[model samples]
Target chain A: MASKTSSDITVIQPPRGWSFPNLREVWDARAILLNFVQRNFNVTYRQTIGGPIYAVYTPFMTMIGYTLLLGVLFGAQEGLSVPYPLFSFCALLVWTLFTNVTQNATTSLTQNTNLIQKIYIPRLVFPLIETCMQLLTFAIAFVVLLLMMVVYAQPFLWQIVWVVFYVAVALVFSLGFGLLFAGFQARFRDMSYLVQTINRLLFFVTPVVYDSTLLPAPFNTLYIYNPMALVIEGMRWAMLNVGEQPALIPTLSAVGVSVALLLVALLVFQRLEPTVADVL
Target chain B: MKPENAIEIDNVSKVYYVAESVTEARGRARVLRNLTSPLRRLRATLAGQSAFGAEIPVKALDEVSFEVPQGKILGLIGKNGSGKSTLLKILSRITAPSSGQVRIRGKVGSLLEVGTGFHQELTGRENIYMNGAVLGMTRADINRHFDDIIGFAGVGAFLDTPVKRYSSGMRVRLAFAVSAFFEPEVLLIDEVLSVGDAEFQKRSLGKISDVSRDGRTVVIVSHNLSAILSHCDLVAWLNKGKLASVGNTAQITSEYLLSSTFESDTLAGEKRFRDFVPSDKYPFELLAMRTYDDQQHVRSSFLNGMPVVVELEFKLGAPKWCTTTPSVRCIGCVGLSRPICSIRDRITSTRSCKFTAKMC
Candidate 1:
């Protein structure tokens, strides 16, 4: 043998009817998580003519379609003087990141049926890796949005750096929702579709296409407390310096709510992990 | 748990929910059932009954209890669905037991599949590290054994080629090589030896022996009796969902093979063969068994997919009324269940119907 093995004892017992997340184990197994991340990245563009080049242009192309549909068909309406294309692109970029992250998270466990059923890595690794992939895609889309800012002759706001914070909030909340549903999707095959439909409906509720500040009072009220609506509007404020500057009270509370939701979702994920393996 | 015991499983049981009511419903009906399940469950709970028994609880493993000593190989033998796989799954933490506990003394690595996480787009070298990492090997451990893994797999020439381009044999060899080098303190192997070519099996058995010699404990679940008999110091037999017996390998395994009601379902033989305890109901026992090649030379291993003749020597003294099954046409001795028959394409038969038998 080339090396001496570590002698760590493990005790396996019946689940105690509640599951508390094993954060230490998840941290210790980070290398396996990296390998999973590598596998996903390596396979993402296989057999495609453009390869990972699509990562750069796919979001750009989708932006084009949105620009025509939303920017051209529906002109800029009281958007505080920013070009329609730039405003919508900023919102669309954040929205896409949320949907992509949530969609992948919702199906992560069910997609790797072979790995989950045969091997014993922390199941949390799947959704976590997916979140990483979505974040990487979000970075690429942010770069594209920056290039658009130059084309529209938009001012380079130092506040643009805060876009990262909005991305974090979107990701954290989407991950929480995705993880909670991914666990369910393992047992109920209908859950993936349900999550996708919910995502579609969520887009309209979120201030992705239209300005929440310009909406009537009852609807503009969404910007105050809803984490997702706060995220989209916050991204717009950070990118275009639009709408009431997303007050510190709302921003801090939004972050607090999203983080709390993630913690609860993680707990639910741990509780459902064992039963999910059986169904998958 | 004793200091010498590497694993102590106390009354472990794994339960599964078989959703019959949901499964029986057609497409739209299935969706409807899924939608109304919570309400139905509520109604049933109010009535102190079940929600149409949709999920029938199955004890795949029922109160199975056993111990494996350090530096030894313990074999788990059981019929199909007798909970062998379920027990291994519990030990490996792939699934949790419904009740009871299992305490293992050291780090555990399970080889349930040969190449569980191998990506087709990845090269052989990349897969080596990835598979090793997935199986709980640290990056340093993989680096130390990298050269050995390559040499063992004999795929140095194609190390950089994507696994998809490799021949099927090459893939199997590469997959086996990574698993063979996995050095956990306690190893749980479940019939993974039945994979790959014959020479690969030899290397697998050798690796297993190497692991045992290193003072690590191994718990193997396999239907290959000869492999188990040659390697295991102790054996546990599971009948139905419970542990039937555990003791000396030679004794428990032979009793397990002869006593198990495995092929009895198809056989018209006497009901005595179905006895959970062969010694309790009948005096019949398997004396010795061996495998022979076409040249009639005794051998411990056979080539992959090749026809091999297995000879079984059994004691026979059943009552005249306990007639043997007609399907079994023995060439020698008064009647028993053994038949001097032929079974080709015996890819993975736990119990073959055709074998030569002699009454001693």
Candidate 2:
């Protein structure tokens, strides 16, 4: 109905499909996203006794416990070439990053109800900002991984660069589920519990604490399709060379699944975006 | 030159679904909710029903439309639940309307909240940048107005101090100052002038009027008629989610003020059901209402200083719940944003099992 054709004129309407927030607009608001990431990173550790060092504490302590039980007590180290702590610690760091980032991403929209209801920043930007916060933690924890590698005299493998690839896949996989569950969580506030329970079950299946090759024959073949297993096995192969190397077909298939989940989750997010302000 | 009109709102409407619980436990809904909650919800979801209850769809805004001409100050006035805020929210794109079209020229900035996303731990300086970005201002824009914002908030000495240490007045002023620097072509203001001290309120009004004079269209929703009358060139009256009237400030405002009284019995052939405000805090529903003079004749208009009795009838939801006393205090006087009086409680008709509150 607007008679003007100047670029300055904007027409607002009852939204059709076009109302789904565009990526370009989200990119244009990158300043706001940076602010969100910076604020969370700065404020989250301010009142803590150990500050941001808490990021590395979880993976380190859990590795010690796993080494005592699985290596020293159970002789679980017999099947591995590298020390149990190094192998499990590498797996734990990747798994920890995924879980921490995923949990924050899942609850991002519900947690910032104030900002969503008042400010006009894109709703999709929140999950991205929250996911970015976990990266700082990963950066801090990666330093510890290097220190432990020096302690055990594990030679720095050129394949160690593949750790970055596995981390990227891990992040993408976590973000996919995070976006998927966030939509459900908005309507049903208890949906986060369901998400955490699923993650706990997945923790066992992904071989975070145990070696992947220990699985029964039929289950070993089926494990190739699991995205988390892909991340953990790929990280173990690249960093420690302690497990069966990730095969090409399985790695490609798992990455494809991660990308597919993200696309599907985006559709779900678009469907629920309009109702967000009302429900919250 | 810019477009003739900065905004074109076409038949805009918004609908909200308000869920109402079907069966609440007698005076102890909390206990029941705590026990059988998740299982009941899962069953309800499986059966395609809401566990809480059925949702009643409410038409928050009907098909009403009005345009703000370029450089004009438009005031949206209505009582609570009249869709004034809904319209503002739609304009700001905080929520999409259910149906209709709104054409706006240039950028749109909404002052829907003061200091939106303000971090308690961040310093006043950091908050200025963060809050500015939250309001859709770019980094360059905040930098351009950095000193002005500090001067306006009067927090120059404490710019590096944490906001948690600032006094409440300082915090509000700081927030208002950041929002006041936003330079969108079409600005939506929703009751933000009521924040801060009286001095800050006056300063905000001045900044808004100054924005209008600079060829920016401003839409302000406020209960303060005096502020609206003094600043607005146009006034729009919304009644029951519909536009009742809109025109020059003097005419529309006067017409709206006369018709908005709760007890307007004199308007013949009009059944204003919205005159009865829904009490969500209590289960009781208002059945009917009547006003009476000292002569025992029905009346809504009264001479100056003459006291009248307002008899309210409500249908009690639970008989046993009437054991507790309920009080009603009429909020906000005619066209004024202050409580004039809480009428004296004269009677409680418990024999009929219907609670009645009478006030002076």
Candidate 3:
């Protein structure tokens, strides 16, 4: 008979502060991530009648709210010969992505908190899924927003090409900000309330309900400090060819801010990742 | 190749900081000011609050390490807060440790709760794929095992019914079947068998045993001490988030059970069959009875048909009562509160009386 070895009884531990994920090791669990995202999308719709229909229709309702509140109620001028519905629809397209992604990301760690504490997957995956799911919603809403713009704006503006570029930037910005807030919310908890408040405040600060022409030169420069302002403005310019072209300097500054925030968010999230299970 | 160990958790430790108070202010001034408020701090401290609700770091697991060899079943025994679930979660990759690393050799499937990933709106069939997907099974793999999984769950009648409509027992059975069939290299099961009826429990256990025999590793966390002891070949005892002992199942379980001081109950009863002659009016006999351990040792101390000796002391009243035999009755095995027993032999004495009997 052969003798048993100690490895037969004892588990081996990994090195201290191991940060880099062996991609292949993580990749093997790709089915889990895909299933989770699919489940979330399916669940979100299954709870309602014509679920994907609602996802598509809700953006139009939001556009009506913006049309009434910003276009008719507050009388924010719609320039570049774009109809209020077309312009507001464009803003809604981008803003919904930002808001939905942020909300999903912020609550990702907290709501599925039990799952977070019980299993170990890359923590980043939860928020990333939220972003991707909302992107699907964004894509559905974008088609309607584009059709309205072409139908009402009197001509097909190839300027709609810029929508893709703006969407990419918006996504990166959302991920960056979403990560920062999600990490903070995991710890402080007060960040949950703060995130909602910030979202409301940001609606006014960004051109979501209005045009960038409402702002003067230096303030437009100051607007870049709020990265979403450039994103919203760029989105409008690209989708409706509305208002002033966002200056290159401010655009570059916005890009720079987004990159910095993304790096910082990753670092902060990683540094705090180890504590998340404990805190939660 | 000889199968590698399924899981290797080395020196895993997790530390949690409990906030004393909900209020935490940013910067140095808040800290200094809070220090001066002794009364507030005292009140908060008494209430288990920290300045910023003071952070008291608790070590959930401290330098704990263990392994489950391939195809072997390991039982994790621990008191409440012993970090057994925490250890399982780390191995399952649900939570990260504060320090240390865990490397699992193969695909890990976990059933931390009976319905850990079930969606209420999705029907039984839909959730099968959803849960399968969550457990790292590709759709095609799930398709391959689809009939086996559904057949094992025995929910064919309600296959299209939303899971919310299924009874809790049905849900547990289906969820457990899904987990069992996923066929990962390592399976982490946490107290899932406690959910269902005895027949279901037996089914689930049989499934788990089959998984182990198929050259996969299993780590089980259960409060059913006897179940764990009987099923596990290797047992690890955890106390207060630390490893109390680890080795052979018998040695560890006995040590774990005996180390605790069990309280004894004074009022206990036993059952007996006796023939007693009635004095004047009536004559009857006692049929059956039982004695209960007051210290909650009923299961721990007694097994079916085990002989137990009992001693009884009493004061005799009168000779007239001597004709009646003392008899005892045992009752309340299923749902009755107290066991009823009769004494067979009657005693007549002025002083203290002692009688010894063996309980059947």
| Fnat for every candidate | 0.69, 0.63, 0.30
Better-scoring candidate (DockQ), 1 or 2: 1
Q: What overall lDDT goes with each candidate model?
A: 0.77, 0.79, 0.69
**Model 1 clashing residue pairs (backbone):** none
**DockQ, prediction 2:** 0.29
Model 2: per-residue lDDT, tens digit, B1-360? 235888888899988767655556642564466356777754543333344544677899999888788889999998899999999988888887889988988778899889997999999998998998898888888998999999999999999988999999999999999988887778899999999888888999999988888778899999898899899999999988999888788667655664666444554322234426455655456665555666666655543344555556654444455666744433323324433234434344422222222321
Docking class of 2: acceptable
Question: lDDT per residue, candidate 1, A1-280, as tens digits?
Answer: 3233444568888666455678898897899998888778878877788776666565567667767887678764444468766777788777777787788998999899988878899899899999988787777778878888888888888887887788888888889888878876776577789888998998777777676766777777655687888887878888888875677888898889888888888877887786566767
Cα error of candidate 2 at position B354, Å = 46
Q: For residues A1-280, could you state the per-residue lDDT of candidate 3 as single tens digits?
A: 1112223232224223324433464475567777777787888888576768777676688878877887888776434467788777777778888888877788788877867765556677778778888898888777776567557654656776877777887888888888877865665576678778888898888877666667787875586567788887887777666776678888788788888877777766665565566555
Model 1 misplaced stretches (Cα beyond 4 Å): A1-7, A56-58, A77-80, B19-34, B37-52, B261-360
DockQ of 1: 0.46
Give a tens-digit lDDT track for model 3, residues B1-360: 134666666788976666545444554556787767856754543232243544678888998877667788899998889999888877776555667877666566787876566888889998898777666667887888889888878899999999999998788788877776767767888887797788778877888888778777789999887678668879999988899888788777756764542225232343334444342333222233334343423222332233333333322233455565533332212211222122354434433233333222
Query: Which tens-of-lDDT digit does each residue in B1-360 have in candidate 1?
Result: 678788999999887766655344364575577567766643543232333445578889999988998889999998999999999989989887888999988778899998989999998988998999899998888898889899988999999999999999899889989999898889999999998878879888989999999988899999998899789989999988999999899778756755653344332321222334374455444445556766777654333333556665444445456565322333343212433233432212223333532212
Worst-scoring 10-residue span by lDDT in model 3 chain B: B331-340
